[model samples]
Target: MSKPAAVAQAAAPAAPAFDVARVRADFPILSRQIHGKPLVYLDSAASSQRPLPVLRAVEHYETALHANVHRGVHSLSQWATEAYEHAREIVRRFLNARSTREIVFVRGTTEAINLVANSWGRDRLSAGDEILITHLEHHANIVPWQMVCAATGARLRAAPVRPNGELDLEAFRALLHPRTRLVAVAHVSNALGTILPVQEIVRLAHARGVPVLLDGAQAIAHEAVDVQALDCDFYAFSGHKVYAPTGIGVLYGRESLLDAMPPWQGGGDMILSVGIDSSTYNELPWKFEAGTPNISGAVGLGAALEYVEALGRRAIGAHEHSLLEVATERLAALPRLRLVGTAPAKAAVISFTIDGVHPHDIGTILDSEGVAIRTGHHCAMPIMELYGLAATARASFACYNSLEDIDRLLEGLRKVRELFA
Candidate 1:
């Protein structure tokens, strides 16, 4: 994604007017002080602070609807099953997926990718087959395929990212060959904040008859994702990144593809019937969702999606973009400070480094100031190596973040520079 030329020419547009103070009030943690200073949370890309609605939803489910699903005839069991399935429906609507059957709830993005790699890649890919991916992928996307390749005798190939942190489309096109079995890449670069051109990537891969999977952990909250619109075969995202509980995430697969793939795991819910000789698997999603699922986490995720919809995704994006613009200008003006990712278009993440200051030191000093930011490789070590950096201090934004948060971050960075100098 590239910044619009209009924004570069004129004053960056003001974020659409909203009652941000009221929004802030919904998150109780935001009100607390850290180190005797108001917490300036800018690490949302790592995990967003859950609001009242999500917290309440989880509480309600635990208190009132606590029973094993799809097992018993009791009222509590029936009610719990309804709540659990209803959460699946919410996930289906959230992604604009064609059917609820397409949504598979897992522990998080990492588990979801591993599920695909084990269930789909391991069975289908053979010797000499290639699994195409991008250099911008998170470790969750990378290691799973590597594991599958080693098991299946398939090769793993990565497309290059340009110096500006954008994917090299031509290189990606060239990499898609006759032996390519799958194309898995990040919807947005987790470390660099570069929103990858997923639509184009999908188009190119589809033209070559290869299915595409997107690691959408970073894009789910910041971008409007319609699986039907994107036409990707699979999309994976973590609930925590989108203001939900930590243990829940989603894998949205095309119903046809999911139906064809074997169950990733075998356990209680995933079986239609179990015999000593052979076991029958359940239908589409439940097959992949073996054992006891994260029932409360799914409830919280549904509530979080509802909360985000009520706030309006477009409005939240605009506000974050405004914050990004302001932070970029301020950080650029500071001497000896270098921005790592400068893609033309980006989400609200900013990765930067100051001369003579280690990123860990930057994070520690920011913590002392009650300003939270992520430091180190951020689970994308390949990206760190790409830019010739060991690590970078990353400040990421979310709906609850305000311009004042950026101010505090800058103040902390200045202190870090002075201390180092």
Candidate 2:
């Protein structure tokens, strides 16, 4: 072979096919500077930055197809309704839910949880019944059930986490008793980035005749989710966490389960007929979705899912895992840095605290260095309490993140240490 041919052959298998540079280009904000330094956004677990396609999709909806969906017969209304329903179908495919009837759009994970807590819990739960969550759960998963417990006189039971930050699976399984009405857990822990064994959790709950709801706000972007394969009764995720707009999320429930549950909120769209007497509610999904939904946000979420599909989730997962390894190794080497979650299986998140420095102080220093990280309890205060930590500085990775971003984070941590010392 010629020299050029050999060189080309060797290089062909050297690089990954998924182009990180091209992916980064899709997000315009990645190019901007923060405090005169290039922005290193490591807070994707909180809310990912929107790509150009998602932005354009929202803009197109507002400009060309702005109408009240499902309530009008005009051409524009028809177009808007088509777009809105198409977005629901996209969510259905994204989660591999059985039908569009299973998909319910809500404000976000918080509202979705509230929907289940109010609708499902109100019916199935009774006094002394238990809801099983985990120490790794975000507040969205925790608080709704707490409110339900308070309202219905049911009790909330939390499974513990191991010292390494992984959920104690045996303990979780043991918690599944006949009195356990529902099992609500996060598929991925936002604060610790711990990937829980959700499939097993679902199976265990099902064996005990309890329905499981997997909170996928952090898991949706990191992996492919199949509700059928997991056999979860309910799953919820926020669009903003997956590079879509805020104020829109999805709740996927089994059609049988959703049909049995009453409406969480009564509003214009959720009702069928309202006379002087009682009113009839809408069908399965719409029965849960009240009032005017976040139509533009749903369109953007559909576009974001399409964008992720084009990128290929397996490739994105591999790239993100590689970044996590790089960040973990680099961050672990820093002096006086204590990593919070040391689970063997984790997503692209690192929460750490430097000795003699508060997490907020670390956050401020890193912010000054143009690296964005989440500081504090990260809405999982129970997990913090379990770990005996008030807060930790968290840096989460996404498809657009690079190893260079990790380097910048390391540099910022060094600066933090220097300032503290």
CA lDDT, every prediction?
Answer: 0.91, 0.89
Clashing pairs in 2: none
> Which is the leading candidate under lDDT?
1
The residue-level lDDT of candidate 2 at 135 comes to 85
- Model 1: CA > 4 A from native: 1-16
Residue-wise lDDT of candidate 2 within 95-197, one digit each (tens)?
8888999999998988889999998998878898999999888999999999989988999999999998999998987888879989999999999999998
Collision pairs in model 1? 1-345, 2-345, 3-344
- Which portions of model 2 miss their true places by more than 4 Å? 1-11
Residue 242, model 2: lDDT of 92
Expressed as tens digits, the lDDT of each residue in 244-312 for candidate 1 is 999999999999999999998888999999999999999888998899899999999999888888787
Candidates in order: C-alpha RMSD to true structure: 4.7, 4.4
The window of 10 residues in a row where model 1 has the poorest summed lDDT is: 1-10
